[model samples]
Target: MEHRISKQMIRKIPYFEKMLSHECLESKENKVVLDFDEQAFKIILDWVERDYTIILIEMDYAFDLYELADYLGLDGISKECITYFHKFTIEHLPIIIPKMAKTTKFMTSGALDAFICRHFLDIASSFSKVNRNTKKTFWSKFPIETIEYICALDLMINSEYQVFDAIMDWVLSDSYLRKCHLERLWKLVRWCHLNDKDSSNLVNHLRISAGFEAKLCSPRKADCDCVFNRAKQNCFVMIETLDIKDLRVKVLDNNFKLLVSQVIKEDTSIASNFFHDEHVSDILFDSGRRVIRIDWKQNKYNWAPPLESYAGLQRRIARSVEYGGELYEELELGEDIANGFLLLESTETFDLICFEGKHLHRFSMPIHEIYKRFTTLNNCEATLLNNKIYLLSNKAILYEAHYFL
Candidate 1:
């Protein structure tokens, strides 16, 4: 059936040629309906007439244009429409900011500081993960005033540790050094003390004027005493570089050994899962303390308990299961007896697969003897590989299973 356009439809003019080409209207013989605001409809009809009249409405209907453009699949029109709206939004920010600030004032200063700090730090941290040119563009748009404000806010709140770290990184960078000002340096030092408990090192590192050096250091016994004495006084314009090779060497050795122990523990726990299954037959090896069982029926598989049960088992075991380089979410077993796989029985199964930034997963399982096995299993690690899950026990033995959903 033919649809009649009302004479009052204002949008019918300029948008007519464009609307007719939409895929939604391609089958013209079929019944069609057009919905729009009464005022907008009238303006459209006015544009359609011989007179090329433009209507300026007080209401900035930018969002409406975007919604309509996207809904109609007007790719070219959508871009042009959004571009105009974006310009309008930017031009109107002065009017919007005060209104937003008033409504947002009830928000705690700490919370606002945290929100802004997180946003800026996220932008800074994302640099390495994106393309090099994109990283440059991101930094270019991020104003120095915004960075300074974030740094100042961090100093005021003294809660967000990552923001503090990001600010310190900027302070230490060559770019920051080139643009360094006395006020900025003072603010940085003040912020360092506010956020970090151990600011002696950072305070000592600041490049201050010789006259201000005394203010940064502790007063001599002969001088006037103040409770808030500076930690140290030597502030030279040139920063001293320390040889970090020895420190790096020590950290590497200790860290490597710790990592190795964690791996072995996780592997042992995963291996122990072999014993949990009653279907397994034959103990292949017994060292009095630990026994290795063989599951001949379900294909040859070996099992043994993990070496030790420690507090850091969850993280260590997860790394071990992912040693072959698979990604999986780590789930905390709420009760002593809970099954991990049973939790993914619902439609939202994808949420169970942990990705970076998602640290927690909650799921329920039926009470069973297997649940007891889970409680006994310490340092539990789990990962999804090739659509199957590999869970490691406290003793570092691995259990292979599949996603129920």
Candidate 2:
């Protein structure tokens, strides 16, 4: 069986153009036996025949189409394939990664490989509680270089021990074939991020293993205590009512599990207070522009410069929000309060503007109307805590806006 395609359509594909050129033997003979995925080739021919317009593509055939398009130097089809793959969720990773691992060329492109590396932590966390054998073999399909890249990433969200465990699991999946690469991958682990117990465990493992030596290396640049602690610490909310001495505090983890709840009676007077993830502080804003932070736990005081005074030290704490913008130009509106949202407060209304640069919040409801769903509004103060909006009132009432999540 043979299919006839116009010369104009054939010229659109680089492979066909070059093969059917005047200098080629196929052009002189006016016929050529081409070897390629027949289905993908037919799709390409249909696309070209229709004046190179975009066509609906089946996701199942995208991989094969992408490979043929790449071989034929069709940027349009390759881009379409990449766009389709970009929407893959965690469930699709196990299947997609193994297919991608079949060729090193896929890893070199940085399009799909970088996506996998960036979301590797999420993917691993998702499978942390699966069957032991499944967890151990989850990354066995990853190529050596891809694994090496992920191993060396500045991933401070989890402990280095998890990273080490992941690498070991991948290696032990097929020890006879993978054990030789273990030493090389082991060196990429940031040993400084390991806890005392994990460090000791690694030392014990090395004592038993052959051809391995410990090397001293600096911690990964992202292993700073601030970042490490941020990843480990849960969000905390400190509620202050009109009664200055009575304060309530609650700590919640990422999943909104309440870890701690306490009520403290103190002689201290309240001013402009800053609610942080770890502690509560009564900040003193003065003429000198100095901000004093009080550690509620130890009753210790520390003085730091006002963050707004220095350009580099400025934080996103917007007090007001303004709206006006056109296409391609977003009018800079309010400052950041929490998680990139601006709190819009007024006498009649209180609302949050979900700030996405260039993509402004198009709709807003009255703040008091929103408050009606949770609690009665009576001179309430709003602040971001634990990734939710806390509406505190003078009557010692606490209301949480879970819609933020």
Question: Top model by lDDT, which number?
Answer: 2
TM-score of 1: 0.29
* Candidate 2 Cα outliers beyond 4 Å, as residue runs: 1-114, 125-137, 195-197, 209-211, 219-405
Error of 1 at 375 (Å): 24
lDDT at position 247, candidate 1: 10
What digit string (tens of lDDT, one per residue) describes model 2 on residues 227-270? 33312532545344336445555557777788866665543343
lDDT for 323 (candidate 1): 17
Q: Looking at model 2, report the run of 10 residues with the lowest lDDT sum.
A: 312-321
Task: Evaluate residue 183 in candidate 1 and report its C-alpha lDDT on the 0 to 100 scale.
Answer: 39
Instruction: For candidate 1, write residues 71-151 as lDDT tens digits.
Output: 545454446544443232122322222333432212233434433332343334333212323322222233455456545
What lDDT does candidate 1 reach at residue 306? 29
Number of the top candidate by TM-score?
2
| Model 1, runs deviating above 4 Å | 1-114, 117-121, 128-141, 154-164, 171-178, 185-197, 208-405
